[model samples]
Target chain A: MNLKRLESILDDLEGFSDPNIRYEQYVTPSYVAARMLHTISLSNHIEGKMIVDLGTGPGILAIGSALLGAHYVVGVDIDSSVFQIALSNLADLDELFVGQPPIDFVESDVTKCVLKPKSFDVAIFNPPFGTKGNSGIDVSFIKAALDLTKVAVYSLHKSSTRSFIVKKGEQLGAKVEVLGQFSYDLPATYARHSKAVKAIDVDLLRFSHR
Target chain B: MKLLTHNMLTSRCLKGVTNGYPLKIVANEVKTENVDYNSEFIARVIPKVDWKVLSSTASDFGVSLPEEPPADIESNEDMLRKVHHALLEIEITQGDLICPETGRKFPIKQGIPNMLCNEDEVK
Candidate 1:
């Protein structure tokens, strides 16, 4: 599907009703998700690829990848409730899932789960930004995603952390590149945010293992 | 979860557990949904799956596979279909993925396997 079609399909997906602050559970906008997947597809990785989404809140990335022709997709998250929502969201788009396997939503923490290493072709997620009480959680998610895939990993992060993430990914033996930038619209979901909507500098990143 | 996923899952990192592979399944509900048969995808994924674990686990559900993957799987359509079904079609809707070494059960409810453990369970 094209970018406009992909974004429209993704816009219909349900978001977290009570997003956990600890996980930095923010709904990735459909426009951004569509853009990210489109970029990955340009690299010729989405079609016929085994894709995994770590911390897959509401299954947007996983579903988007499948919609883009990923062969088999797995969506992993620690939250148990999201899968129920994800399944229902998937069922809403029954026509789209005609050929694909229903996402295997494994309920597990990304850092700890010994998910088959170097097995999947690609990994994708909007990992916890590692804020609040959870420090370094973004790096943890990046590391976990890297372990699962042989080809590449895709994610979004704060533009401020580019240097740090670039260094960290290289230390882990992957070539990291910044793909694009956006103003991540974080609708105030928690008690702490004083604004109705908060927009933050966001950078889309790609890490590849050749 | 599909066998394609179970083929990769292991609670081996759980504290004090050894050989936590091929998690034993205790199925309360097993659901089979028909999916498209894609031979090329199945052929590509075959080498990544452990035949022993997949075949033995599939046998428990009465879908018997051969003792080993065929010599030339890319050319064998029937074998590819069977693996595709077992890997993508069959699911444990409500079950427990018990770690083999410790018998620690990670409950699978609503067709999703929750692998998170209690505080003391983490190393």
Candidate 2:
């Protein structure tokens, strides 16, 4: 599907009902998600590939991957509460994906989940940027994602951590690239929100194991 | 959870457990549906699957498959169809995935498995 079409589809997805600040459950703008998935699709990495979305809240990326022809897609998260909404999102679009791989969601910690390592072809996620008390948690998500995929990982991190993330990826022996940057206009969904909406700079980074 | 997903999960998250694979399945509900067949994709992914786990799991749902990928898997349309069905079609709507080692139970409800362990149980 075209970028505009993809974004429109993602726009209809449900967001977290009770947003948890501890997990940094910020909404991923449909426009930004479309751009990230579109870029990965352009690179020819998604089709017929086993794809996993770490910290997949609302299942936007996971649902989008199945819609785009992924052979299999699994979305893992610590929050079971969001599974119903995420599953409902898939059910809402079930008619469109009658022939696609089964899209499954698992409830578990992103870094500590028991999913097999080096099993998936690609990993995509908008991991928490660790702005909360859980400092350095994004690194754990990145680490788990890199360990899960055989070829590459696509993730979003705060632009402020670009250098640290780059260095971390290098230290983990993966080739890292800054695909693009986005300004996340996060809705004041949790207690931390001072305004109705806040804008945070996010960088889309691709970590390739080559 | 589909058998394909169950084939990849383990209890390694539990403290003191290593290689907690081939999690035992205890299903309270199982659902099946037909999806468009894609042999090419199925053929490519077969190698990555744990065949022994998959074959045994298939039987639990009354869908029998070979103990391993058939020797002629690439061209075996009959086997591919069964593989596709077992992997993607058979969903364990409610169940428990027990670790072979610690026997720790991870509950699966409404088709989603809760694989999270308590902080104290985390290694």
Task: Point to the candidate with the largest lDDT.
Answer: 2
Misplaced by over 4 Å in model 1 are A189-193
**Per-candidate TM-score, first chain only?**
0.95, 0.95
**What are the Cα lDDT values of the candidates?**
0.86, 0.88
Per-residue accuracy of model 1 over A98-194 as CA lDDT, tens digit each = 7545578888888986687887999988887776778799899899888889999999988989999999999988999999997877867532478
For candidate 2, write residues B1-123 as lDDT tens digits.
988899999888889898899899999998887766789999988999889988998998888987767799999999998899999998888989999999999999998999999999988
Q: What is the lDDT of residue A25 in candidate 2?
A: 89
Each candidate structure's count of clashing pairs: 0, 0
Model 1 CAPRI quality: medium
Candidate 1: Cα lDDT at A24: 75
TM-score (chain B only), all candidates: 0.95, 0.96
